[model samples]
Target: MKVKQKSICETCRKQKIPCDGTKPSCSQCRLRDLCCPGYQSDWIFVPHTAQSDRHSGATVVSQSGIVGGRKRIKDPRPNPKYQGARELTVPRVLGLSVSHLMTLIIRSYVPEPELASLDSNSNGANTYSQPRICGCWVEVLPNLIAKGETVALSSAVRAFAVSILSGGPMPIASLASGLEAYSVALRSLQRALRSACQFRDELAAAIMCILLAELLLPTTLNSWAAHLQGFGELMQLSGPELYTSGIGHKLFVGARPSLVILGFLSRKASFLGTDEWRCLPFGLQPPSAMQQLLSEAAVIPSILERLDKASGLPPRDRAIVDRESLHDFVAVLGRLGQWETYLQSADQYPLSWVKADAEEGAISCRWFNNITDANVLTHFWAFKVICLQNIDELAGNHPGMTSSSQFSTSFRERVGLSVMISQSIGYLMQDEMKLFGPSSVIMPLRTAYDTFRAGSSQCKVELRQCNEIISGILERGYHFVPLFFEAFRDAQFCPMSV
Candidate 1:
């Protein structure tokens, strides 16, 4: 029998070069003046199979000399390091992986400064330590989802992030996935609430997350109302105790804008008017001038609600209601004037109105010249406009309301104020669309757009500019911008006489 040739040295075989089968040293190695790497008895040459066979979804020897097959099953046991980790059974949605999805969600929801803080803090003593409550949903929650814990909340968070990523009008499949995730999250939340689970904070955070997802869904009005109401109730249930913690306080403050918007939309004062809600921290003492201004501004929504309810009464009843409301309206005007005076006097938050020539008209505008604090200025002016809008509504709609020259002058002044604020916002938004994302000033911009006199050519031009900025926001994946745009269009067609 012919003797089988000895296998080539391991190094030569690995290098895919011919190796003369020598016991002490291969000819290839000796010729190269290199140490002979020892050979294995089991070494054998194996050529790659046909492409068709390679992709048949079966095991094969890979190019790297390892046996390749379908993905291996992950171990079911919880990691000792991650005590509560659960393996997710629900398959990840196609296209993006879990880690990628988590990254996108974190970037979209978490503020840049807060994220930077998290990054800096990550290198501390415990690398795997849990982040604050504000971060828990975006950071720790993803890991929990990967381990298959809190599926509902995770699904909702994922759906919201995916919806945002899809931008514009979402694809049908993506919409379906979002809806399904939302459904799962809602049901899971209910179950957790009913059960005796120890993790109340997690559940509370989930409720907030679900609320965020609902907002992204651009859900029906009733659905949005329900989510807001549910969140309000959940926050109440958590009580004042929740606000005592640093994370809790941060979350509470962050949620204030949503609460204000929801309160305005629902025409409900109880959301913000409640003693419990008011007891929550507004700011550290001595409060910033901006904080003081916001605190006073927050009361305007309730006043508007009162005016709205009064407007719905019969002429006779409305006259009585209007008389009572007139006092409140005058009081509000006084308060607003006082705030404006305070804003003017406070050196800390200095504001000045500069006259500028616009294409449509000459307008007096107040904006923060400081680029960094422009958003604060936007909120300040926006709140002022909102207060003025309510005052205008109350003054114009009440049956007993006098059209006296005094009232007319007040009304004219209010109109001028609204115009100035709207134009200023338009200019600011135009300049800072990239700096402050579309959603940052969308509500206030929408309010300003709607409140501006529809018939004025100047107002119309300013409104068009605002719409362009909103459209830009829409192009950047804020689908909800269009809804507001549509509402503005409706307001234009059927202008609110009030």
Candidate 2:
């Protein structure tokens, strides 16, 4: 039989094998039992007519025996609407993204329920005021940054986020980016502050972001004070109108703890005690009983300031000042006692003894059990220690005399209180630690650590445990931990084993 010469089948061509060029199927496909994909016929050469003409590179013949070239059609481009259809979907806040980590850090400061609700809502707007609700900044900040609503505030948030991330085993690139963001944010904040009218909310938010950043990031001790001061100035400048809004209320409530700490550290009254704060509805209501205690505790600083001034005077002069300040001191103590009574009676935080197995012995630890309650109790005890320390100072007792057998009884009591506070702190959730921030625990822990006697085993053990907790906090990517650890070391009566 004569073999026909034809184009190779499509399947044979694709397989790069020779074809028998059969009409129905290729020999290779037939022999292998594979279905053949038929091939197109080869183009046939045709003689062109004299009347044919080229039009747009294509040959054509008119009815009048004139040939013209057909216009070449361009391939259609993809529709812009469907161009991104095949792209992989991603969350707005991916783990590596600065904004994503910021959202995590910010959410850490907020309650879980609020975070869940915020995640569920498309808009994430705060429609109502609830004590347990997460701050509006936590929900709104990521969106604001995404939308480029406020460059200064967004940069500040990014700076803060990157700084927190820098504490972890991050790439060198991330550390450089964090530094760049910090520089940009600081410069932007200065400009924003200069043009306050245009960037009121942005400026306020930036102040808060920077304040929190200062608290969490490695900085000079009490560097957050400047930001807190600026925040207060801005709030005063903006007036009550600012606090009336939902976001404003969230910002104020979220920042109140820092303000209280600043007040104590500065030995002055908290700005939250001002009439402007008093006038605002949200400001009038403390978020929790603990917050109220903090606000009330602001008076301690003012009283201490007076006592310190009085102690510096001549004996005759000091006696007059002391008598005059006596009434105020008594009233402040009375208020503090009332707070203690309320705390004792508060059913929300039930006290419990937690027994844990330790190397020394089976230690029974006293804690409120609840994280917030434990934090509050710890702070309260620290405050009491401060009160006692101050009272001791006012009574002409030398600082070095605390270890004397005569004063040893009170010293032991203080030491026991400090131990309990440290133990309570260990029970706090990682989320609570972030929410409260390092500033919340630093002073209390320092106060507790200061009560220790040099070379005392109990004191050394407590310091070691506190240091371990601080180390855990460091591992969690809080940059402030190392600074706090340094402060703890500086304040330690003697070198601790840990």
The per-prediction tally of clashing pairs is: 3, 2
- Candidate 1, which segments miss by more than 4 Å at Cα? 1-103, 110-115, 123-149, 168-176, 196-199, 280-294, 311-317, 337-372, 397-436, 453-458, 485-498
Q: In angstroms, how far off is 66's CA in candidate 2?
A: 76
Candidate 2 clash total? 2
TM-scores for the candidates:
0.62, 0.65
Model 2: per-residue Cα lDDT at residue 213: 56
- For model 1, give the 10-residue run with minimal summed lDDT: 59-68
Clashing pairs in model 1?
A: 86-147, 86-148, 87-147
In terms of lDDT, the best-performing candidate is 2
Error of 2 at 103 (Å): 2.6
The 0-to-1 C-alpha lDDT of every candidate, in the order given, reads: 0.51, 0.55
**Per-residue lDDT of 1-498 in model 1, one digit per residue for the tens?**
966445678778778898766534567886788877645555332333456336643232111111223321111221234343221211222234444444445544543434443345432111212122123334444444555546555555655554543321323223544555566678777787788344354565566677656656646546766876777777776675566444455455545656666666556675555444654564231323444444565666676677678767788897676667666656755776787677567555455455454444433355554422444455565665555555555567653465555555654554555555555554454422322334455555666666554435545665555565555555544555455445544644312111
